[model samples]
Target chain A: MDKQYSEDSRQFVPETMSNMRFAVLVLGHGEMGRSMEHLLSGRHALTFWERNLEDGSENIPLEQAAAQKDFVIFALPALPHAELAERIQAHISDHCICLSIAKGMDEQGRTPAAVLGGVLGPAGRFGMIYGPMIAEEVRAGHPGFAELGTTQSDVYERTRELFAGAPLYLRHNTDVIGVSWAVILKNVYVPLLGAAEEAGLGDNARGFLATAALEEMARIIESRGGRRETAYSLAGLGDLVTTATSTGSHHRQVGRDLVHCAPGDTCGTGMNVHSEGIHSLNMVQRFGLLDLESFPLLRLVRDIVNEPRDVAAKFRPFLDASFADAASRNTRD
Target chain B: MDKQYSEDSRQFVPETMSNMRFAVLVLGHGEMGRSMEHLLSGRHALTFWERNLEDGSENIPLEQAAAQKDFVIFALPALPHAELAERIQAHISDHCICLSIAKGMDEQGRTPAAVLGGVLGPAGRFGMIYGPMIAEEVRAGHPGFAELGTTQSDVYERTRELFAGAPLYLRHNTDVIGVSWAVILKNVYVPLLGAAEEAGLGDNARGFLATAALEEMARIIESRGGRRETAYSLAGLGDLVTTATSTGSHHRQVGRDLVHCAPGDTCGTGMNVHSEGIHSLNMVQRFGLLDLESFPLLRLVRDIVNEPRDVAAKFRPFLDASFADAASRNTRD
Candidate 1:
């Protein structure tokens, strides 16, 4: 540690834990990655790399960047996560902190944690950052909240301390599996909120879906050995509500478009729109990690997204089926 | 059972268990009561009564209505529930089903269930109908969902059967205390969402608040011997999101207004608008049912509503304190 010059006060200060600057490597130059770079550049020794390297001056080789940093943030989409981790595997120090901000499933329906386990192996100190902090909002200095889910307590502490002076707020929990599933599944549920909006169900439907979605998510998480309460935390219920209601979200747009589009049709309004929820549904179905029978709402949303025609008609059967199940449960009890 | 005339077909049908109609007494003529009447009138023999007798023809004497009816639906505000229940208690049939649709704490912080117990004793069969069913939406024949919380299985079954052909969907649960507390406490948390919106915290804040509010409500409910999962159900999280985000909600409006109003101000823009959340806070403070120490968000919302001022300033401390607690917890773990 060395004396660091403060941009605000224009004076050198002796290094303290709060002001300790780490050599940080941020993967990708996307919106989220840039936002992280902006937030961390002034306080830390920051380096960035993008696959294409549009600006070659600031870019470094992936291996070089991975070997030199105290922290590696995966800001790329989940689809490329495993590949990227594998490419940089040999270069990453065992003690280097690895965190992911990705909130989607890979094509194989592997969560970021699972992908990391395959890529980084058990030797690396790793975790993830997931919650409701949108990149633009974070860039604007709006107060943001996130959860750090990792198996290692020291990893959580180091990650927590890394963002100590930033506008972001972080909470640490050891339920990595639970938090990972919550973040991954929220992408699958947000589009249903959009479908509810398209159906003119009003605020009441939004409220109903909000709770119902969390309960359904809880069942799926529990089936996978994740805690049910995690679905009620920032990573699950919080992120679901936020993403579902987000004004410019792609998944919500897909829902609105799916309502108007014919069966087996891509939305005419966008040239190549890819909804994360649609991708998630495909991956979840492909992997079959959890029983689909218990998740009526998820099945309904998946059906709607799959056919994307006469959404209301598609939804009614789901309501009938779920209520029928409830009625049977009532009788059994 | 005799042959019953079907309203839709105008033909007589042989009696079945499902078609057995109850003598239903509706206690209010408000939007909710009207909606219920619209839903149940065709299926059952319906009676109406109001203390003021705004409509003379339909209004029956309180004693007559109470004695003859097999079901008494309380659609009035929580403030009037106890007194109304008491006035009609002696005249009520021993086996009459008593149901409340009110979702607020009375002046003494007593939930409608507690008030019913105090007024009706153990003589009357009691339960509550609560969920995300907004009156206007239900009136429009929208699919609605609710939880019927009762002690008796027969009561739950009968209530479920009463709405068998209607758009209202019912689920039975034996956690009457938990469901009652969830519905009551939701009103107290809805304002926090409004406050978050007023602060321009974006969907992230909404997500953060949604999870935080439910967690706080769960703690309170659990402290009072109510089940924590009840807060995640239709009665709690569902209704809270609906009410908090509802465009026409007075409590949400109060939140936005409180942000702009001066200390000790009643939003000059509106005339004598009373918010249920404000009333709820006062009552909760009066009752001291749950420890307020764990509920910083509730306290911040209460303080803002009690004396509308710089809401952002008031909320920042709460954010700091909670994050500090989370960080310390992370380290301790």
Candidate 2:
């Protein structure tokens, strides 16, 4: 623990390391990209890239930026991960650690880890950054915590050193698949919380839903070759709590909108972007990734999303039935 | 799962049970007592006992109520639990089940379960109802979930029957000590969350604090002879989320109050109540139940509560040190 820095110390220089720096490439200058820039700009050499360039910004070519960078951050959403990973694969250096902050599935229902692993092959220096690292919070200079899932210890060490004194904190975990799935699937549970709030279900229901969601997430992660504890960790439970309860969360807004809109009405009007939660739910269901029947809460959320009418009506029965099932299971056990 | 009842069916008649009823004596006609009455009145014969008689209510003697009732609910706080348990012990029926909803320590720094177990001896039919069963939510006819911690299966069955088809749901667990400690100690975490929120720490900080709090809680519960998994269940993590995040939560108000007040100022003003969180913290510390050195988050919270000046200053260092410690431990592991 550093004793010299006070609580208001926005930046704490790591005493163990002096002037350690890395050349970083931040892919896609979105909210997260800008936040990443805010955290890393003073400490590291940073280059930004975006498909659609904003005015007064330098648009660096993908190959040139990837070739020289020690770290490449895929700060974009999951949709473009496959294409971008393939584009940068050949040019990136052997030691360059690729990390992603994406928290949703691609068009093909694959996680960012899967896309990176598939594109970069067996020995790719790729990892994931997932947990309660809310972009706006990071940009505001408040500390953000996350799990860095990578197979290589060197990758973890380098990643740690990169953000040593910054507000972003990382804990190393080798369960890449588990961390990836936990973070991706958590988005699906966000709207359910928002819907509960909208229907005046109160804090008790929120707690129930959050707990139930984590249980279901653990099960889902295990079914997908991931560890169950990973779901209960920062990547799943921690991130879910943040996104589900945060007033500014877009996925929560989608749920609030579902309660007010007509049955057939398109939710998230004027937002223009599809919610990652709804998209993930659709992708998971369409791909038959897991047996939704076993997960009553997830099934309920899916049902409500499919037919955006009488959300409170749909939610109540689900709660009763789920509790009944849990009680019966407890008896049997 | 019952399909016959719609969501608006505030009262679902349990299909399995055929008009089974119990005489329920509710002690303390406060918020929780009224909520219990709202859930159990129509199905069961009800009696209410308050320390002081309200306007038109009949004041049944404690002995008389204890002698006749099938179930006695101590809806009071922990302060009076020991005295009341001893007072009604000899008069209560052999088959009567005594349940408490208290979530704090008594003046002696003992849990309600401890007090009841001490006064009523090993043969006493006592249990705890703890989780996200907020009183206002129950009164509103929204579903609330809880864990019924008891030794006997029959006690659980009867309790389940008591709340069957009602909005209040229960899952039986035999670990009374675990559930009691988890729920009781959760109050202490609430103010930390409130402090974080009050200091303009973003949702990311809330997520980190919640996860850290739960981790420390599990450790504390285990040290106190409870199972670690019990702290992760509904009674611990679930209830913590509800109280910490809820707008109407009194403990959260304490944390928020700590931020605005001067050093050593009386917090939770106008509310006219000492927070259960602070009381629990004081009791736990004064008793030296657990080594505070091992739990950084709890220690930080205690320090902030003791000296409520420059709260943000105190909080940020704690977060950095905790995360740094976690990161270093991860490296060693």
Candidate 3:
């Protein structure tokens, strides 16, 4: 057997027979942080780092939490990761394994895992957990699939061992960069589906958006030095379907409200909503890492967000362009 | 430029500038057939063939319609396709192109297109139109994406030209076999999703099922001499999502009723329903063309349909085994 296969097969032990445990620290009290807390309840020793205590009790400091645990989960927003990683860098143990659940882009277009790594320096170990996981469902013990992306093979084994019986089934991978790009780009592309719904484009519209968006995402990921297939896995296609079609998605609501709001209305209900997608687009525009000419759908969404008027009218031309683009690709050998 | 692509690119004319029409014959005036009738309105000369009209009007005979049209569309179920194709073979015009929209398998596991080909003999030129088109939505003038899969590149060009400005946007491809398998296998895989919903499995369950099912589907398509990427296209993922999640799908209804029915009840509400998925599963079991070991989810669905008690209990072991399989694959590369 190959050396890598033997190491990987070792982590496949059934949960009932495995008794591995770890001291885990979660760095956020947000919805996802709480969900992770619920999932890890009895299987590990838990510690939390929150900025403020709601119950009028003092919380553990971030540095202290960073120093003690074998696993440190960063469930905070993507924006603060670099700062927090820097602050906790001196205190973190050499053996600590960092996992980021934030599926968002930084101002520099770096993923959460990248920001964490940038601050933690070359010695730090990190991984990203991403997929179709909704916080409420995870808290309720509903089954979901996720990918654990890390550069270090031993980190993958340790993370798998820790979540041996957890409801979140984590598949291991070394393509941390690919997972990061796919997860971030999925958020950026999902809003156009909502715009389709608001335009009364029907379910077929969702189908078109899914195929087209994923194809473009794979191309962009490939252009950026990540594997294209990563965009087809649980992190990209699975989460895009979940976020785009779910009536509860705030990002989707942004598109709906943008179209539904009257032309003169500047401040609609969705105007103030936190959309990581819009931020990601802005970062994409700034970075110019990908050729925007390749992605008609992403360009359309960006245009609509900038000027929310006559969505259906604007989208018609976009559709024509996209169909032409598809025809070109389809006939290519 | 390559000769094939030049012809395809010429067919890629924008809807605004294109004005091409053909005499179209639609076989079987079922819901989908009627929807095609509606979509083709004002764009072409139309003829319809139904066994018996509800109004008792004298409909055009099948043979006459076959001989008159430039395009002959068989929109009937897969089982009836062989008989219909054989009956019309001698009458169909030598210049006519055939398209099949039926997404079902015959008792011998032949797809609708395959059945049509088997009866039409070697000289017949054919294609398939498959995607997320729900009949009612098409009738209501909703836009939908579909692929025109044919080995003849000119046939693709001609078909695209005919539907240039129609609500049904057609993309061209030469992978007829791949599209046929993708469209057929999607019908077989969609019912399990319905079963998932009826079991009170949360939306995350849908996400997990979507990712896992498509992975297994691509493998099955590849094993059956079809391109695995076909499963990622509109014909597979697009149609599967539409069918599995649509409130009106009868196959989904079959799964829902099966789980909700009481024990010892051989005849549930869904017992009388004609599910293409159920028929496809039966055919698969008989043929044994693909290894059942590679598809745990498909096997679990087949098992539940055979005996519909305790969905979660039966599903747990399947998930465990799947995770183990995933772990093994992850370690290998």
Candidate 4:
């Protein structure tokens, strides 16, 4: 641990690597993207690779990003996740480990790491950075932390060393699959909690949701071939708690909006972020169609969130259904 | 589907065989055990195996519970989970199916199903029921859904059928190991949420906690031989949401009290109704032994809830710590 680590340094410049200049190619410059810049500010040598709004450049041209950096972080949205990876595929260097901040599954439901695996080939070294560390917190020097997952143990160690002097706590995991899925699917649970709270549910409701939500996340991550416990670690559940509990959560905004809206008002795009939850809830239902276990609450959330309704009323029918005979089914075993 | 299944008449009993009326013997009259009765009443021939306060005689001793009934549900605490199964094993009939309503892992950190399978030899079929449906819900005619997991799909179906017309939504799964773990371990997430809520977090905070909690649950269940996607199902996330969201949730009650008092202070005695969550959380820590994936927040809960002030201070650092770091972990390759 560096003596400087305890001190408030917006960016920690590794004295050991002062001569080593690395381009901090940030794919997306949302609050998270900006936070990454702040974390990497004086820590390493960095060059810019953002699709500058003023410059009116198309999404940060991969060719330019490739030439400028020693490392790359793909911090884009889920929809643009694959496209960005595909664009940056050839540009990622063999030695330069790629880090993904975008927490979502691709169109194929593959995580950012999986997409990168396809883009970077068999030997691709990938590192996943996830947690509740928002850009605003990082900028404010409010000591925060994150989880880093990598197939190679050394990659984690190196990333730890790189950020050794920073305030964020970095943890390790072998199951990037679990961590990635957690980072993505966890978003779905958040909206529901928000809706529950908006609907006047109490602390007990939050507690139950917390446990139930993790159960659901474990199933999703495991389906994607990640370690189940990884979701419980800082990477998955821990980070989600921080984000979902904070003021800046996009899901919270959506939930507040859901407070007044009627069912089926999902078409409006006025919310701060794309309701990735809508997609995940659909994915959960798709699982049901595939003869998978029924995630009824998830279906309820998707339905209620997209189609604004009597939140409590819409949510209650299922909750009110019979415990014995109310269990639904039409699936062929 | 018997036509008589929907009626109040006793004349038309199904003639799959002679009138061999089998009872759904509940071997533990705690919340889950009692809850099972409400769901099974008017549907299955019901009886309970708990110590009758009036005469102090259980209908059938735990030792004889397995052999006498067609279906036996063991809804005991984790401490005696293995012992209950062992007792059931001693009394189990050759063709009886043993189901556990206990949603927690055994002493070896194995699912109750796996533990039961080993203890019961080849004489009995072991299965698990997991989800958010509480005994109160079943008693109130509310939908009480749960996942019944077993090795054979037929067992799942049969168990689901046994709960027929009882106002319970039943789901069947092949991952008994996963289902049991998901159901049991989720209890750990509750107090953690309660603690966070106690600490004065808002909707976003709850949202973050919910997602992270489920992610953590998924990882924990998967590590213990359960499926990941199961976490996404009703057994996993759905149950967590319900438990975390309601005052009806016994676990959160402990948490709410813990913020100001002790668990014993709130629930007069384990006698009125069972608080499986209290025991489940303890069992989780005992069985998990440092299995960070299962209950990272539980340690804090136990300390804050059970420990002295100064000792609890160590746990406090984490409360203020960035959840991103707390949820994520050891990212070394």
**Model 1 TM-score (2 dp):** 0.90
Interface RMSD of 3: 4.4
lDDT of 3 by residue, A58-154 (tens): 3777787778779888888787788778878888788988889898887787789788778877767888999888776666556667888887777
Tell me each candidate's i-RMS in Å. 6.7, 2.7, 4.4, 9.5
Stretch of 10 with least lDDT, candidate 2 chain A: A1-10
User: Candidate 4's error at B2, in angstroms?
Assistant: 31
> Candidate 1 regions off by >4 Å?
A1-17, A53-59, A267-273, B1-17, B53-59, B267-273
Q: For residues B1-333, could you state the per-residue lDDT of candidate 4 as single tens digits?
A: 233223311211111122234577777777677777656666568778776768867665566555677887777755456766776666766667778776655556655676777787755576877776666644444445566677665566567567644545455677776777677656766766665556443332354455555666667777766787677566776677667656566776655555554434533233113445556665556765446444555555556645423322333355334333532343311
- The lDDT, on a scale of 0 to 1, for candidate 1 is 0.75
TM-score of chain A of each: 0.88, 0.92, 0.88, 0.82
**Residue clash pairs of candidate 3:** none
**What ranges in model 3 sit over 4 Å off?**
A1-17, A52-58, A121-123, A267-273, A328-333, B1-17, B53-59, B121-123, B267-273
Return whichever of 1 and 2 wins on TM-score.
Answer: 2
lDDT of 2 by residue, A1-333 (tens): 233222433542222243678999999888989988877888899998888644644477888889988999999999989998888899998999898999989989998999999999999988899999777667666677788888877788788888876777677778899999888778888888998789766688899888888888888888899898888778988898888888888878777877886755765332226788777777788898878887777788778777778777777577667766766877787
Collision pairs in model 2? none
Models, CA RMSD each: 6.0, 4.4, 7.1, 9.2
How high is the CA lDDT of each candidate model?
0.75, 0.80, 0.76, 0.60
Once fitted onto the true fold, the runs of candidate 4 whose alpha carbons sit more than 4 angstroms away are A1-30, A33-100, A104-128, A134-158, A172-248, A252-260, A263-333, B1-34, B41-100, B103-127, B136-142, B149-155, B173-248, B253-306, B310-333
Error of 2 at A83 (Å): 2.0
